[model samples]
Target: MTVTLAADSGRLPEYPMELDSAQSQRVERLLAGTVISLHDHPIRLPDPLTAETWKLHSGQSADVFGGDAIVRSGLNVVLASALAEPDQRRLLSWAAAMRPQLLGPELSGAESLALAMRGEGSAVLLALEDLGSIGTDLVGIEELYRAGFRSAGLVYNTGNALGGGLGQSTDGGLTEPGRRAVAMLNDLHMLVDLSHVGDRTSIEAAALSTAPVVISHAGARSLWPSARMKPDDVLRAVADTGGVIGIEAAPGSTRVSADTTHDLDAVMAHVEYVAELVGVDHVGLGPDTFFGDHTQLYSAAGWSPQPVPGYERLALPDYVAGMENPAEAPRNAASWLVRRGWSDADIAKVLGANAARVLESVLR
Candidate 1:
């Protein structure tokens, strides 16, 4: 699937005509009133790779204020799998048994304290265990959804009971159970995520889902035809359903090397491509920027036998050189958009407005 756009284009339509001009102006004014600050805040979203990598790269030094930073940044929601009671216990136990040497002394202590202080923090980490290795019965998933699993994907880079992944030997589509899972998720108001699901799975899920589904973090194949990107057809399908596709950082989804010089440009090219395909409303950022060492955790978990060659040492800085922290990401992206001639309103949508819109629909 190819997506082409005329050069020197202006902004696209914001939304359906259901919103009156006065209402639309009010919405735009409210969005514009949000000042993009320069403070470095703790990241609120869960990027498994980032959490694990931070521990490995930077020795586990307990940050009592880390949770505070996350809240101040207006990131009160976390989509995580390992933070739930049972899953957290399982992960800690597994880490202790499998890679005791990798564990920093402070990690175990912090985990214990965190569990004891559960609910003291303002942000909610929606822990979701990988059902890839587990059977596809989805019993636990049903319970989690009832408890609030607002976002989920059938598989994550490997063949699972639900479906095949991009890394699977056979790029199979949705299995019977996978199809059933999608239906159940839709029925339960869970947003299906297709970031790592194979091409066939993406297409099938998009068709099956009544609500718009998101590829939470991905790039454009037109920019780089890596498995991590969504095809133009898939992008259109997502947009047609009113879903948003988030462009990830360079290392995870793009072909751009980690060279500080051209990496940001490469990332912007992807954002532009997706915007061209589905317009600005369907394009956003979920850049999976790992602040520390992820390769070590991947190896420890026995998830990948070999390290991601050439990417083993890649960290958050490699993707956005100067923007090493979460707060910096929005600022950097906004600056780039302005340079590309985007209006403040358009830039605001790309930064967070678009993602918020999709979340409000699916999570409500």
Candidate 2:
């Protein structure tokens, strides 16, 4: 178990619990007597990550979503992915003040997992988008970690000094400053997110980072090729770094609205492709599905199913029938895994085990 993928081998890391037999026992034993978690149960319940997963599933907002809903999601931990740099101070302050309990990155693996197993409290992992809040200073990232920040993405839908995004005309890959920034991230033990980065950036980052990184929320382009989804090579690179590819529920990636259809099968197809491409261990659930109207929300966020250079004919479909939102999407995904005949142990990994393993590797 000493050998890890290490950005060169294109395999999972050499952690002991990575073994299905071992990790499954650890998770099952941890939740021995707990109310059989229903988020994974056939009867769908709530999840506490992005929104009040239940309500988010039901389409309720301005209510309890985001950090406030994590505890309700039956998860012991949640990552607040890509908070606004400008509003980060205020956002972090509010997160620190939430009742019911909001632990930071200071807890031990045993402590956090134990609390989660009991469904008692939750630990919030902070993720950042840009370095603008720190005036482009790489060392300033350490201050961010001290402020409870633990993970970050170098770009959003657009590129920056670090590298390119999906929309980049010509991806220059990781610049010198971007390399420094990555080094700083490893020094502080922060998990690098490759979801929104360009292919070159994602590939270079996977090789550059010593610690395993994550494509926290994305889909397989091989299923339905798109600029936003990760290609097989990039996916393999992430796998090599011992990282995980979280399946997203974004419109272009999962469903197309122009076609009236239930896209649950389409979404599952991406998961299946990842598992088949790089073993079940490399794949996990990262449904970036929305809580509200897909069209309204995605459009407002400037997301359109425009045809990329090669993917010109592909347009966004109108079907909202698949894994629609957070509340039930994970459950729906689990159901697919079960139908595919995945073992309970591998299903556990996709649900949260792999994510947990990566978190422990960096922040433990």
Candidate 3:
């Protein structure tokens, strides 16, 4: 479905914040902490529909977040589609081959910790947005784990052999195969994310998984009411499992109202809502952002901005200000919390510690 673009498709205002001296000081202090992003596509993505083959924008992945305090980032393979076609499979095959070279060195859990302890940033841990690339086979999952992916989602926005997705008109929830897949992921120590899964599927996966289950990059459905956002019950289920819901800042996905400017303020509203609903410990930053105009990418790929059954469609911003890309989101998001008078300890948890605790447990 083609989502009609709003009139103002030009770049939205940048950084749109004016912090006082005290708040500026607080932001600086927060930047010194162990910031971690639970989900982000740090690398630039080419339009999958237009590209003949998979290719990323030219840059070393490590340099993408240069000097940022984000010690760990959950890098997801966002382009991996749920389609079972020969051309798509070929694209995925090429991506899998290029993974090692694109991401540089793979750091084990201990190695990453040691690096963080030494004040050097930790290596990026890879995750799959969904298990679509692997179909229903355990061997395919094992291959990905061997390739250094420590986290995965059961389904993307649509159904797979494993289960139904949020994009499906009718969700049948998890299948017997999906339950088996969840168990295998638990046994393999892979972190489970339910960001784009159907509501019933998400709740069931969280209940069945032995490990903590995250909605790695989404917001509260009650706040924005998008299909991409999680409902209260889903959020409760994840929190019950001691998991974190990483608040996302993707343009139009996390707005407070249909007409609200899709900016850092909009992103923070969802953060505040989730933190209040499930405690600060159960919230973190995901900011599934990249280095380019995300709306343009969606337009090029013929993708609609995620909308639910009842809610009015969100007006897309050219970019979500201050949270436009991975480079700016961490500090800007933390700074927004500071500006909101959130306690330092709470801000720390929301920014990184909460995610670190869950990720470390499963990755260990």
Off by over 4 Å in 2: 1-73, 83-114, 117-119, 129-135, 255-262, 301-322
lDDT of 3 at 67: 19
Q: For candidate 1, lDDT tens digit of each residue in 173-290?
A: 8889888888887777666888778888788888888888877667887665466677898888888888888776634445455454435567778888899878988887665542
What Cα-based lDDT does every candidate model obtain? 0.54, 0.60, 0.71
TM per candidate comes to 0.66, 0.72, 0.83
lDDT, candidate 3, at 24: 82
lDDT of 2 by residue, 1-364 (tens): 1111111111122212123555444444433322111111111123222223433533432222343323333445555443334444654553354322335445643465457655666554546654545545665677666666677777656687678877676888988888888888887777888877889988998999999988877777766556778889999999999888877765666442324343667777777889899988887766654444444443434435535556567555543344555444554555556556677777777777777777767764
* Candidate number of the best lDDT: 3
Which of the two candidates, 1 or 3, achieves a greater lDDT against the reference?
3
